[model samples]
Target chain A: MENTITSIFDMNIKPEYLFIHLDAVDNMDAIKQMAVNLAKQGVVKNSFIPAVLERERIFSTGLQFDETGIAIPHTDTQHINSSAISIAILKKPVTFQAMGMPDSKVNVEIIFMLAIKTAHGHIKFLQTLMNQLQNKVILHNLINSTSKKLLINNFKSLFNKEN
Target chain B: MKKILVACGAGVCTSTAVLNKLKSILDDRGFKGKYELSQCKVAEVPAKSSGYDLCIATTTVSEVKCPFIMGIPFLTGRGLDDVIKKILKELEK
Candidate 1:
């Protein structure tokens, strides 16, 4: 079994998990709902929800770049049956109890749901993730990207550079 | 001089993003001072922000006080200017 979460670029669209909408609830909840919907699709497993919640409870996974906050949700390996990721873009901002600064709230705009199958994968996956976060140019292109294929390609280029 | 401490889940990824933006903004805006950049887990954040003028987190952290700003926007420079202004305004005091 592969012990790492696939990079956003390596992930193929499940089609069912891909959703674009103007969320009505608190933006945070809207993003969580996206994970839940994906869970129900048998994309991962039922345990994924609590795992996500647990991770959230431990610390906020809000990806802060610029004033834009991207909420990326993931759980321990024990919680997942498969490895996948979901991305949800909110039409408006919602207040979230941000990490590090509980007193400050995060006005979340983009949320990426990460589903990991194992803890070992977690480390490797995060390593790539961290590298990607360093380059604002790539990040800008990612946020500016519209099509999923473009998104994936942009991400894969990182690995290509590793060769 | 504004004292800022920026941290992310691993300290390198998100926190670095936060620091780069801040350095750019502060430089462009002509503000300078001592700043600290490091990576840490959420559990360590509470005890970490001390003697620091401001705290920047890309993940959830609590049990610490001072001005806390999330680095989410800094990742893409999406809604960063206003937030940088907000933090700078407070630190300028």
Candidate 2:
């Protein structure tokens, strides 16, 4: 289990992958900008933008936390070249359809755009992420952290703690 | 063993997370040997849900044959006790 977690939690989140206070008026715009940034970083294919958008339209990754609203937008492995997670802190919260309840809306401030290369390969990492999000203090720190370096360090520490 | 189906959007990411959490919960409740778990995508639920005793999914689905439980609480840590109670009750029946 430890080995599996060590391998699965190998997130390629760098300082460059972290965006702070991005100016996106809507959910699509937020995903597009993040996907484009990930593509430029050579983490995902160029087709990732559209595919992520379509998946968001259908599945709707919007999650409502007790303290704030966050979204985890991801698509199939076909649209990705590698596995990477990009973090974007929007300047203004954008409206997103809540997960499991499409009729409900969540105004999201932070977006975790996941670019995965395969299905069923990163279970440990994904579980750790979900468990981490449940902590209000961690989410609060993530959203309030202003420095990109600090954010990267904070995320790395969180992932590291799981393994 | 009782078969339980768990599903999410891509059938890979969120569903697996739910699966692990459910496994531990069931194990803690002394249900480790009594239950079996399966994971799939939401699109496959309508087709595959018939074989399972219960379907626990993170995403909303159309019509499923068996009793369905929402698995979001497993992730968000909100109302998780109630969700687990529902699962246990369904398994008991």
- CA RMSD of each candidate after superposition: 7.9, 3.8
Enumerate clash totals for all models, in the order shown: 26, 0
**Candidate 2 lDDT, A1-163, residue by residue in tens:** 0112112365567767778998997999999999889989898888888888999999998888897899999998898887888899888899999889878898898999888787877778888888888898988888887878766766766677766
Error of 1 at A101 (Å): 2.0
Indicate the worst ten consecutive residues by lDDT in candidate 2 chain A: A1-10
- DockQ for candidate 1: 0.15
Candidate 1 structure, TM-score to reference: 0.55
**Residue pairs with backbone atoms closer than 3 Å in model 2 (clashes):** none
TM-score between candidate 2 and the true structure: 0.94
Q: For model 2, what TM-score does chain A reach?
A: 0.92
Which parts of model 2 are misplaced by more than 4 Å?
A: A1-8
